[model samples]
Target: MLEIKNLHASVLDIDDSEILKGIDLKVGKGEVHAIMGPNGSGKSTLANVLMGRFDYVVTEGDVLIDGNSILKLRPDQRAHLGMFLAFQYPAEIPGVRPWQFLKAALDSKADANGEDKMSVRNFSKLFDEKIEAVGINPNLVKRSLNEGFSGGEKKRNEMLQLEVLQPSLAILDETDSGLDVDALRIVAEGVNSMRSPERSFVVVTHYQRLLNYITPDVVHILVKGKIVKTGGPELALEVEKDGYKQYMAEAEVNA
Candidate 1:
């Protein structure tokens, strides 16, 4: 469903310094791929570039959804084409209530896709149902988006967005980073519930704990801005047991 070809990106306006050297990956429909790597491996950079973050400039390569290139599309344009990125650090919108923010987002997507927006009555019913299913407090929706929310609450809110957005491809960048065991399980359950033949997930994490709950169809080791290894769930276990020292050295040698 998603393809990255020789993707090379650099932090814009910063000496043309490259972060992603040459990333090539393919994620098929109904597949979940986990990217595990050490810090400074450009894991999050790949996610941001996929989302068309302006701060990063893609000097080469193309990111495609389905088969068409999305290099020229803006972030929201990518969303219109069924791409979603759950931020590692969710931003707090001080004055935007969760209900308002989500409703507006869904409406915008609907409008962009030439569909009718959901009626407030109907939307409220569905929203509340998801809130219950995702185990988010209904009261949390009344507050400004992520404002004053605990780390777990923010992650829950991210899941709530995923549930409502229903994107074809979801790229979760370190969703389990700050979450405790309970929160991690909740987040994993939320993701697992969304898995299906038509949906795909690219879960970028540093540890294997999250993988325990949401087993990926494929696992990849990203090092020095490129994917050096791809394997099944067993690779994650190996990384957990032995660490990335070997991978790091191999990547340097290859470089």
Candidate 2:
């Protein structure tokens, strides 16, 4: 459902150096792919570039959803096309209530797709259902988005967004970071419940703990901006045991 073809990207207007050397990946419909890598491996950069974040420029290659390029699309435009990215560090938007933020997101997506607008009454009902399913406190929705929320709470908020939006493809960039065991399980359960034939997930994580709950169909070892290895869930276990040291050294030597 998603494919990255020799993607080469660099920090926008900052350097001519490429963070992504040549990333080639293909994720099938309903498949979950986990990208495991060390810090500075450009794992999050791939996620941001896929979302069309303006600060990172794609120097070469293309990111496509169902065979169409999304390189030039705005982030919101990508969202409208059922693409979602759960950031590693979620921003705290003061004064924006979760209810207002989510409702507006739904409305904007609907309008962009020329679909019927959702009424507040309907949205509230749907939101409440998702809140219960995702185990988010209903009271949390009344507060500003992620403002003063604990780390787990922020991850839960992101899962809630995923549940409500039901994107075709979800790219989670280290959502397990900073989460305790309980919070991690909660987040994993939330993701597990959403798995379906119509959905795909690209989970980028530094550890294999999250994969214990949500087993991916494929695991990729990303090093120095390139995907050096791809395997099944066993690959993650190997990573957990042996770590990314070998991958790092090999990637550097090849560079």
TM-scores vs. true structure, each candidate: 0.99, 0.98
Clashing pairs in 2: none
Best by lDDT: 1
Candidate-wise lDDT, in order: 0.95, 0.94
> Candidate 1 vs. truth: CA RMSD?
0.6
Alpha carbon RMSD to native, model 2? 0.8
lDDT per residue for candidate 1 within 55-110, as digits (tens), equals 99999998888899999999998999999999999999998998988899999999
Model 1 weakest lDDT span, ten residues long: 8-17
TM-score of candidate 1 versus the correct structure, residues matched by position: 0.99
Residue 154, candidate 2: how far off, in angstroms?
Answer: 0.4
